[model samples]
Target: MNTPSPARWRPNRYQIVTISLALAIALAFSVFAFQDFRQGQLAFRVFNDEIEVLTTLANIQRHQALMFAQTLAWLDDPAAGKTEIEKQRTFLASQLRVLRPLVANEPEIEQRINNLQAALQEYDRLVESLGESPSPQARATARPQLIELLRRVDEALVKRAYDAQERSFVLDFGNLLRNQERARALLFGVSIAFILLVLFASGLYLRSERNTFNLRQRQIQELQAAVNDRTRALELAAGVSQRIAAIREQSQIVVEVVEQLKQTFNYYHAHIYLFDENRENLLMVGGTGEVGKTLLERGHKIPRGRGLVGRAAETSQPVLVPDTVADPAWLPNPLLPETRAEVAVPIVVGNRVLGVLDVQNNQVGSLSELDVLLISTVADQVGIALENIRSNQVVERLLQEYQQLIETSPAAIGILDAQTGVFVQANPQMLEMFELTPADVGQVGPIMLSPERQPDGRLSQEAAIEHITLALQQGKNTFEWVHHTRSGREFRAEIHLTPAPNREGRPMLNAIITDITARYEAEQQARRRAERETALNRLTQAIQGALSVEEALQITARELGQVLGRKPVLAALQSTLLSYDKEDQ
Candidate 1:
């Protein structure tokens, strides 16, 4: 009876179970409260992001309006407003690009963005048309359409932005209500368990604080890493850009670009696949490593839309494969067996896709969005460089062909400075005809090619200057002149002077010379022959009408002497000549 009365203050099993249940409920409520807080934080972050997107869209619309106003002003006064309009247009395009990523997940917004893009394109076309011919008719036809398209785009953006704002407000309000309910439940549970769980609550609070500190540290580290990666990407981009800028040849540019990409970015491999003349296949133009050499030897080609590189070129967009083996669009090459990731960016200039820049890595998810952006920029630069190189090559080839033709021409041609009347260039025929070398003719004035006096009784110096001036003013002149060679030999030449366009965009004189020395000699010989014939006829007629042979002989001698410009001796025939001939017979 005394032992039974000893445990009077001890609680029963049901009471202990009730207390345990309350503690459990309190702990569960605390966990739910933390989850709710986390969810609230996430919701707030999402709401803030949505607000930013809406703000950006609003800014884009404002910029579009500004651009429209500028365009109208430009249409009104093209010369005064063109620069401002272009500036506004460029700003609007940049803003639209900024807005593109923000609304990419919203279908309706994306559709509206697409429409805006199309409208902007149409506006650009109309603006270009107006610029080309700033006629009232063209403006009347294009301005209304442009204004309508701009208004539609503006309305679409504004509506989408308003809709997004409304959705964000609804989500925020719902999240707030849910958080308030969760907080009430958490407070009730905590009140029920506080009397029994002070020590437990203290321990849990300490653990949460430690976790928060750890999370903060981890976030700091991640932020630092991101900053470092961004800096590294920027440095790599700048270095590659500088290197690409220094290169002049297309093949050299491709090779340097691929090599830089591989070495700087530490990519597993880098390759450039350019479109062939037919544009049906992408041929490997430049690459790095032994796999590249093997591919080059094998003449590796990717058809349009066949693989990542091909797809990028076909679509003129970038293609990224985080895991090549898992991506259906990726085509594995035996030469690059270790490749786990790959990205192909189209090298485009304006509307032309010159090639595809393909880079790969040995690790999955090695490439980031930053990498894509940097590489895309590099691709654009490479495309521009390749276009410039091709254009320069074409110009050089044409210039070489023109120089060859000039050197091989049969006519004696020389180029003279229009301003100074000095010889700038001479063909081989011209140099040979003048018996002068290039060094001797260099910087020599046109008067150097002629004697002191010309056939037209003008001083050669004054005449050459006058002829150059006339050719420069009238575009062409042709006249015959007497000229002297380097060896002091004078010749009659037909000089043709024509104005020609030079490399400096200024006019130069092209002088073509024709020698008429042989023709002049032939004409003189024919005139002398005619005069001799006339003199002989006159002598014959005088002899026929003469009374005596002496008169006829005298007339004949005088005529022959006059024609020959010298004295002529005549011999008389005697009767003794016939007697000697008869005796011999």
Candidate 2:
């Protein structure tokens, strides 16, 4: 085996090419590394731009919120605030212009910009149509659109800032980029000198390197295999963690994860399979090359525990087949006949298996446990990326939906000062409940908003304070109280109170007032009906027990009067004659 062959000594295209292009490859790698340094430099620049973007966005949102305040101001004196509103709108537009270029690269943010513009236009039209003096209802309906404008501006900027912080790796490498600058010139000179020296030395060493090539071929190959496997795995793993972290779509993530695995490792095929709604099968969601396309088109899938991919997903672990031909569990596909080695790694998040990442090579014994671990690492990152995207989307959706719910809910909602129980702000339903305007909120006290006495003989102010105190102490409280509108209309309300976000160094409560007047009246009618039945039974028993007619008559009158809540009229045999006094129970 140690003896050298004449054929081995003969110059091959590989060695010749390696010999010829070694210097170029080295220089290119160096230059590429420099480009990476330049990339880090550029990242810093972009980060600075983002900070400015945040500032600009904040100003725009501030103007939007201020415009809302101005609308409230307009309610006070419409004629005086028109020019100021126009001026604020102009400033908002100018700030938006400044923001456009900064986020031009982001289509999502750009779309938000478009929405913000449309909302601004709608707001303008609505405000203009109010026509000098609008009804309280119209003005109330129109005031909150400005908040939507604020949300449009604030939501994107906040998300962008968070994403910017997360995606910016240059912060850690910023110091390293500076160090790279000093070495660049020296590297270029050494590289040139080394290239010239290598040509001369390589010519002499060709004979020696060739003679020893046969002796070292086995060792070189083994080392190269191990090195290549580690390198590809590390690169793929790093790419999953860094390069694709900014990708917000799970579909894109799955595709990129598998495609990069196939490309970087020179695998014959690579694919990602995700669980369907029922999770009984692994469906090919993403893959590489023509085989991947064919499989996806054919709607390829493997049932749980049926194949390597399925087994990986089912167990939430990896399955490796170094030689698929010898493996009894390997699933053969005619489209991927070149698969001689295979590996499948589960894409798991917590206890849930989302999918499997599968890759195959054409050469037998090409895949190994190291490949399994590396692929599994990539799979885990894929899981995290997908989960993060889902969580973020959920949170944003909930936030938007919550605002819409608060804006449009029919239940009377009001924000109150926890200490005094005075409404600081109220929704339309709350305003309608009290027949009060926005301006009346601060002026009205708990007792003024409600009747002086509760149905339970408790002071309205005292009961309100108790409820507010309980909510502040225990996070939430629910109770019933009687309230009177400004028009002296009394209605029964069931108030649910919860602690709200603190404002101005004081606690607050969100009061959800449900009108229970109808329900209360229905229950009271039912109670009276039951009481009348009980009293009739008792009166019958009393009449049966009475020995004298006069005693029976007196007992009948007393029972009738008690039941009717008034004096009973004496009738010979008809005991139904009764009258009710308006002022008496």
Candidate 3:
């Protein structure tokens, strides 16, 4: 009555023959497709090459026109235009050279390019001759000839060459289109034949598949399950990566990672234990739930290799215990008394293991190889986050030290945004020197600290920006600046602006300003003293060399008058009263 399960429906020879025919047709179609693709690619390459050649020729033509303009510009202002003319001439020559190679395949184009080069050389000779002319009259005479030569080159050489290349490109493009159409037709026929063969083969295949449909369906289901599990693992890794990356604190990263793992994977308990400085003990640093809090409060510690966490940390490897109760090394914690299975993955950075990420479940054998793999991946992310946090902490410490140093420094120091020319930070000494408050820090620009005009007669704002720009370009600048304070008191400042590395990795200007007014005044005093000494020496010499008392008095009076910037009257009591007033005499 069962009818032998519908004769078992075994495949016959017809199905095999149909499958062979289908495969052959498919192979033929594939070959046709490959040929068609290759033909299309060749057509594209040909079109691109043509376009490149046309573009090069066009660029050369444009440069030639620019060269002509520059030549005319030279006629207007020879001194300024000569340099630009020479540069344009050099560029045009280089373009000609580039075009020469591109058009080498076409004899007409190549000949045209050669003629163009010859014309360019003649033009350059004329320009050079014009430059060497002794007077503008001779240059004026040569201008007509230069213009004629430019017109001839532009029309005969560049224009003709472009037309030739364009015609060649059109012909090549037409041929390529025709070849592509032929390939497409052949591909279409082969594809149609392939589709019909495939349909016939599929009919046979469907008849054969009905007998083993249940078995194939089960296999598909298993494969889909595996795919879903892999997808889920990837999604979890992505989520954990994002969460940990945002956390820059080592302890916080650990805590967030553990909590995510427990919630995402529905593990009974999750804990993170970090290695102590001595690398001898694993201390619970972060965990999930009240159980985690209790363990953390108890300051639970385990020596290396003492339990799952310790083993993972010590070996820098993952450890899974399917049945903690059956494992000899399993150390049951009072907080997680119901834990039946445990997995530990090391949180490692480079060659060193920083900690272990442990997950526990209440069901025995609940953790599989996939669970271990996923948790281990998350542990790696946690390790990277820890490394980043440690690096940030180190940078923060260094920054604090630097800020303290700047604050205590005697020289006035300020940090200015290089782009905006605005002050971002100022030290105490800087604030006092500028007579500025902390509130004025960000509101001020480099010019605000300078007088209306500099000692050199340059506008202070313009000069400051110029020097700051120079510092940014060259990395440092040191100059004497006249700065006006809030009280309208002008003083000399020796400013050293250096490019400082900022937190955002951008270049900022560090202005180290030192008041040099007193030093300048002292220099002036020393000069004046030297001048006074010289004047006294000259007066003494003149008096000593005088012939008589009156002469000496006259000499002394004249010398004293010169030194004092006024006439002096010298009187002497002798046999007859001797007197000399240098201005009156």
In candidate 2, stretches whose alpha carbon ends up further than 4 angstroms from where it belongs are: 1-239, 242-250, 263-268, 277-280, 349-352, 384-411, 414-428, 436-470, 478-494, 500-509, 514-585
Q: What tens-digit string does per-residue lDDT give for candidate 1 at 110-202?
A: 777777777788788767766644885455334445555554665555556646665765577566656655565555445534533443445
* lDDT of candidate 2 over 394-422, digit per residue (tens): 44554465456666988788778887668
Please give the CA lDDT of all the candidate structures: 0.73, 0.72, 0.75
Instruction: Arrange candidates by lDDT, descending.
Output: 3, 1, 2
For candidate 1, what is the lDDT? 0.73
Ranking by TM-score: 3, 1, 2
Clashes of each: 0, 0, 0
Which candidate number would show the highest TM-score if scored against the true structure? 3
The CA lDDT at 23 in model 3 is: 79
**Candidate 3: Cα lDDT at 286:** 87
Per-model TM values vs. the true structure: 0.49, 0.41, 0.57
Candidate 1 residue spans exceeding 4 A from truth: 1-232, 417-424, 437-439, 443-445, 453-458, 466-482, 487-509, 516-585
The residue pairs that clash in candidate 1, if any, are none
